[model samples]
Target: MAKKESYESRVEAFLLPLMEENHFELVDVEYVKEAGTWYLRAYIDKEGGIAVDDCEVISRQLGDWLDKEDFISESYILEVSSPGLGRPLKKEKDYVRSMGREVEVRLYKAIDRQKEFTGILSAYDDKTVTLTMGDGSAQTFEKAGIALIRLAFDF
Candidate 1:
């Protein structure tokens, strides 16, 4: 596995039990490098919402755990926070829960000259997602070609 994936998987494994114990959902974990520093970020949520205190609690525990383990070779900033409203759907559970909900989809390549679409999520499986567009057209998107799929929200 790539180093980033390896780090993220290890972090996910460690967080699984903590997540269950705390009644929190693990949205996503990422190990990424910015300008010069590496960052280990955990996105979490709950039925109601995540508060600052929740993030602080998780961050403290996770930081301590990472320190004790010391598996990662690089120094990184550890962050635990809520996946905001616009967070992309990156897992099966996310797709399942989003059924029948309106979603904004972004594709790696444009289809019909458009790379973005907004529609009701009608169906999804391991490889594809079907959306019912505003004009009642059903658009099937290959999951591999999708850059992002997230619940649609208006400000």
Candidate 2:
């Protein structure tokens, strides 16, 4: 577990500068094994949205750096891409950016006999998140209680 985290941290450290230089927001990075294949994935974004070309540019540059550094001993596939529309709000930046947008918040345990709520995200602090529900009522939830929060999509 510690080794996995160490590799993830190293990868994030190496990618941060490259993302900054390319004007991309470093959303998240993960090192995971699926179907017996190791994968190192980097999720990036920008002001509007990230393009395929943007991913290509970052991928090419970061790939070169990774090759030079040779930090990971195991073979892994590297992927650079945008965090899609329903990406989880995991960081402060994500919450800030999501303010005034509709979001679906799921709790670790039921609150008011419900485990999920959908509303416009009104405010967020380190400790809590406030949402304006359909009936014009405001509800504030402890951040620690939330299991997941992501943009809500209407279809």
Candidate 3:
């Protein structure tokens, strides 16, 4: 595996059981470099929501495990938190839970001269996602061209 993928996978493996035990859902795990610093972040959630205290509890435990395992060679900051309202649909369960919800879809390339669209998430499969727009039209996008697909929220 690539270094980034390996780090994410290892972190996820460590998080899975901890999540189940705590009744939290693992939303996503990422190992990414922003500017020059690498960050390993885990986003978690539950039926109601997540709070700062929840994040603190997971962070301490995860930090301890990472220290003991010492698998990552590079310096990285560890973060555990809830995936906020705009978090993307990154996994199967994310899609499952988001069905019939309004979502914003951003594409890597334009389709019909537009690259971003907001609609009710109607259907999704391994290869595509279908959204029903306000105009009563359904837009189906190939998964490969999607840059981000996330729940839509407004202030």
Candidate 4:
């Protein structure tokens, strides 16, 4: 577990400067094994949205750097892409960006007999989030109580 985290930290350190130079926001990085294959994925974004060309450029540059560094012992596939519309709010910046947006919140335990809440993200602080529900009432939840919180897509 520590080794995986160390690898992720190393990758983040390597990618941050590259991302900033290219005017991209480094959203998240994950090094995971799936289907017997190791994959390193970098999620990035910008003011509008990321293009395929952006991913291609970052991929080429980062791939070259990774090759030069030779940090990972195992073979891995590298992917650079945008975080989708429903991306989870994993950091303070994410929450700040998501203010006033509709969000779906799942809790570790039920609140008012409900485990999930869908509402406009009215406000958030370091310790709590306030959602304005459909009935015009506001619901406040502790940050620690939330299991997951992401942008909600209405379809």
lDDT of each: 0.95, 0.92, 0.94, 0.92
Angstrom error at residue 2, model 2: 2.5
Off by over 4 Å in 3: none
Clashing pairs in 1: none
Please give each candidate's TM-score: 0.96, 0.84, 0.96, 0.85
Give per-residue CA lDDT, model 3, range 39-116, as digits (tens). Answer: 999999998899999999899999999999999999999999899888899899889989999999999999889999
Check candidate 3 and list the clashing pairs: none
Q: List the residue pairs that clash in candidate 2.
A: none
lDDT of 4 by residue, 1-155 (tens): 58789888898998899888989999999999999999999999998899999999999988998999998999999999999887899889998888999999999999879999999999998899999999999999999999999999967
Whole-model lDDT, model 4? 0.92
- Candidate 1 whole-model C-alpha lDDT, 0 to 1: 0.95
lDDT-better candidate, 1 vs 3: 1
Worst 10 residues of 1 by lDDT: 74-83
| RMSD each, Å | 0.9, 2.2, 0.9, 2.1
Per-residue lDDT tens digits for candidate 2, residues 34-117, read 999999999999989999999999999889988999979999999999989889998888888899999999999998799999
* lDDT ranking, high to low: 1, 3, 4, 2
Instruction: Report the number of the highest-lDDT candidate.
Output: 1
Residue pairs clashing, model 4: none
